[model samples]
Target: MPTPGFPPGTLDSEGDPIWLTELASDDPNHTLHVVQGLEPAEALEALGAKPRLFRPCVLPEVKPDEWTSLPRAALALDSGDSAALLAGRIGAWTFVYDDAGHTLPHDDTILLSADGRTAASSLYTINADASLSYAVNGEQLAHLNVDDLDLDEELPGLPAELRAAFEAAGVFEIEDEDLEPGEADYAICMRVVCALAGLTGTLDDLRRIPLTVTPFG
Candidate 1:
């Protein structure tokens, strides 16, 4: 629940806005949302949101010992950052997208059902370096290395049209010769999939009615 009269847009060390309120899955089995920015407050509002639309949630965590750990599916500040401390329970499959510097919050994120037909997509341009990625029935639908890709090759393995669509988004570049994309590398792939499937809805839709963000958080 939201704390009333909370004006949004508080900034953090990286200059990303702080999220005072949170969005969560209505079903415990589907309660996973991946917020793109360092703090997702701006990401939430850019989608035309007001508070109290969702249950506040933090990524669930676990303690195995004196040490702490996060699941591999949790969102990371960067691919190399060591903070999986916030692994969530959207299940084994994960959904990936970007806030694109908080420019298109609603279009920037998505949650899909097991069937892959029902989905919620925010309308926004993904970050230049962000990858679009998702899963269906625990099957990963995304590949890596947009630039190194051949239409049918393992580099991307996307259908030609989808691959072309992602290519238009600008591949995340790298100087390393042998770098393989990690989980975050798939955001752009998922973005193109959303556009192709017409899985998008207006941000206003979320404010007026209840919706579910699925797959993984």
Candidate 2:
């Protein structure tokens, strides 16, 4: 006498099957016992026909403090500012990194590779006195207000080892005289970018590929 559409394993009160029509006016709680074996979706569908017998329940709203935190995240910024808000989690700690200044509020757009393995960054800044300065990674790489080659031209007298390192690292082209605000900012940005690029490349090469083996045997 059970409902025709009800799947196997459905039971009845008093251990006796009850006709589907008999459940039309029966209490939902009672009918639910008979259809307990049905899949959740099917059970819901079957019970839906009797609205008065069953109603969907709503969950309580969750508070901000109740939500779990993510491991890696970043801040987004609007145009016009030279900087972007930065926030994320590393290990179990959260951090925020922002810039100083207003006019050119470090509004920079950062782009990362498809796998999140690489990133490119840039930003512009207007100092406290309205001087335009820009930086990347922390080093002041460039300043827009000054231009002179005196410092770079003086590199000939520098120690050979120091000069060689600068040349090899492409740092030799930056002259001390060109160390204006804008240039300083550019230099800083370049250093950070280069270092990050090198580190990423080295890590990826080491981690993703197998190392060659040399044998005395």
Q: Pick the candidate with the highest lDDT.
A: 1
Instruction: Give the alpha carbon lDDT tens digit for every residue of 1-106 in model 2.
Output: 2122222332233211222112111211110011112232232222222223222212112212211111001111222323222122222222122222111222
Regions of candidate 2 where Cα sits further than 4 Å from its true position: 1-73, 80-82, 85-146, 150-152, 156-165, 171-217
Q: Tens digit of lDDT per residue, candidate 1, span 1-217?
A: 1111112332212211122011211111111124322133332333333333323323334322222212212233332332222111122222222222222222333323233322222222222232334333324455344344443345366645445544443333233434353312323333344333322222222234322211111
TM-score of model 2 (CA atoms): 0.21
Off by over 4 Å in 1: 1-128, 134-136, 147-190, 212-217
Residue 31, model 2: lDDT of 9
Query: Candidate 1, overall lDDT?
Result: 0.29
Give the top-scoring candidate (TM-score).
1
lDDT of 1 at 84: 25
